[model samples]
Target: MTPRWTATGLSQDLPKGVVMAGHWQGHDLAVWRSATGRLQAWNDRCPHRGMRLSHGFVRGETLACIYHGWVYGAEGGCKHIPAHPALTPPATITVTAFACVEQDGVIWVAPADMAGSPPAVSGVQPLRSVSLTCDLAAVLAVEPALLGQDILRGTVQIDGQGHDVCLLVQNNPAGLTLHALCGVRANKVAASHWVENLRRRAEMKVAA
Candidate 1:
């Protein structure tokens, strides 16, 4: 029904040392890949002038603000300020960072420290990501068992065609974000077409 990166579509996204604008729940996120290929998530807003950190560049393990050039480490601590090169950045000059983990190529972000692990979707490789205008319930209404859970929670699916789909059911602040995956043997072209079809159908179903 839907594909959230935490479920399946993560590994296919930007690689290490890359930054992308992503959203979770309803919060704007600065999703970055560190030099070591580790994933980091931060509030997209830069502390200096409230610029979007996602638009910023990734230098080594840090993400630099595009506007004022404030550089932040993977832990979200301010490391350097371009305007005042000699001054040590105050420890307080840090963006609110989320705890992000990349396991089996899927990146997961938690607002606070997560006591337990994210939901399971092993044995599937990433395909791609998508967004929709539908909610989790709307998606589940169409395919209840798609979630594999008793409740209509967010779902992760391995399609009959062997493609892995990670459906992220977000609130309508900006609709939904879906991530799809496939087994190593899955056909990339077919998975892409299938995902696109699902995206259009899901968006239309909820929109109507």
Candidate 2:
């Protein structure tokens, strides 16, 4: 449902000291982790010149624009301007920031009162993520929910016994990206192969 963790990004993808453009429940998003390993998400536009902040860089705990070198903090507050180093950027120069948190190795973005906290995926290990050109209905049609279709769904073992799955499906501008996870004790080899098969099956589902 509507939660604070709004389909942010694949955990392993966004590395330290880098800024990436992403989407959160259809909203254009910019996600970046500081040198200290803190993650932040905000509207992709820069306040000064409307530069795409994803085109910016993480220079420590702040994100700096490549065009004119305006820097912002995790709270989306403008912290510096290279051209005029003497000026303390006004509070008005800050970018719109959303509440973000990472859990089960997945990134999430939403408003402050972002409904409930991120769903727990205790003891489950995320496998990999895949995007489907079709909607969730199409995805379910082929792989019908083995348990249920509710949010924070518990999936069946992709490779069977002792192997349970955790799925995070969200809609995007184009389609859907399924952030998949498996039980911590699931067979890695079988899990890997199963994900491969899932791709094939999901692809066929979307195509038809």
Candidate 3:
């Protein structure tokens, strides 16, 4: 089952004034950060002509659909329509918005009505994200020490020492994406190589 909050990506990956595609419980999301660093996640579809809002551009605090230049504000309400500059967009012309927040260097999204805060993941810093061709089961088969469905916690060997690692699992249509983090004092370079090796082993297992 999906949790109340789903880890989308790392905060550092989606910097200010940039938009990226994300997924949460099978919902495609257009996650973006404003010029001032405010985070937001909305339905990836544009209300105008079904164009993907993820293909849109971020201007200041608003997102503009690349298809027809339809501008949506922070509240997901249509602020301007290039075709009708003199007319105000109706409040009904709004994109679906989700509850989005940044915690522990990770970006999380859930239904707007979701309650409580995201799961706490302390003592680790953002590492790297890796997309594997295999599923979660293959990952566990390769490293059974890793546990949890949503957030996988385990100790991985890096540079001849055990280092705690956290893998925020995201089940994407193609496969799975692991938004990883490692202990603050761990060798990040070695940890990253370890992640790559794990991906290789898991994927090879699936192929076998």
lDDT of each: 0.68, 0.76, 0.94
Candidate 2 per-residue C-alpha lDDT over 1-208 given as tens digits, one digit per residue, 9 for 90 to 100: 4544656566888888888887776677788999988899889998999889999889999998878999998789998888899999898888988888887788877875677777676777767777767676765666665344424354555554646676676668887777777787877678767766766777787687
- For residue 67, model 3's alpha carbon misses the true position, in angstroms, by 0.9
Model 2 stretches with alpha carbons more than 4 Å out: 1-4, 147-162
Which is the leading candidate under TM-score?
Answer: 3
Q: lDDT tens digits, residues 22-78, model 1?
A: 766566888888788767888889999899998999999889998988899868899
TM-score for each of the candidates:
0.80, 0.85, 0.97
In model 3, where do residues sit more than 4 Å from their true spots?
A: 1-3
> Lowest summed lDDT over 10 consecutive residues: which window, candidate 1?
149-158
User: Any residue pairs clashing in model 3, and if so which?
Assistant: none
Q: Of the candidates numbered 1 and 2, which has the greater lDDT value?
A: 2
What is the C-alpha lDDT profile of model 3 across 68-92, one tens digit per residue? 9999999999999999999999999
Residue 3 of model 1, lDDT score: 27
TM-score of 3: 0.97
| Minimal lDDT window, size 10, model 3 | 1-10
Q: Model 3 Cα RMSD, Å?
A: 1.0
User: By summed lDDT, which 10 consecutive residues of candidate 2 come out lowest?
Assistant: 145-154
Residue pairs in clash, model 2: 6-109
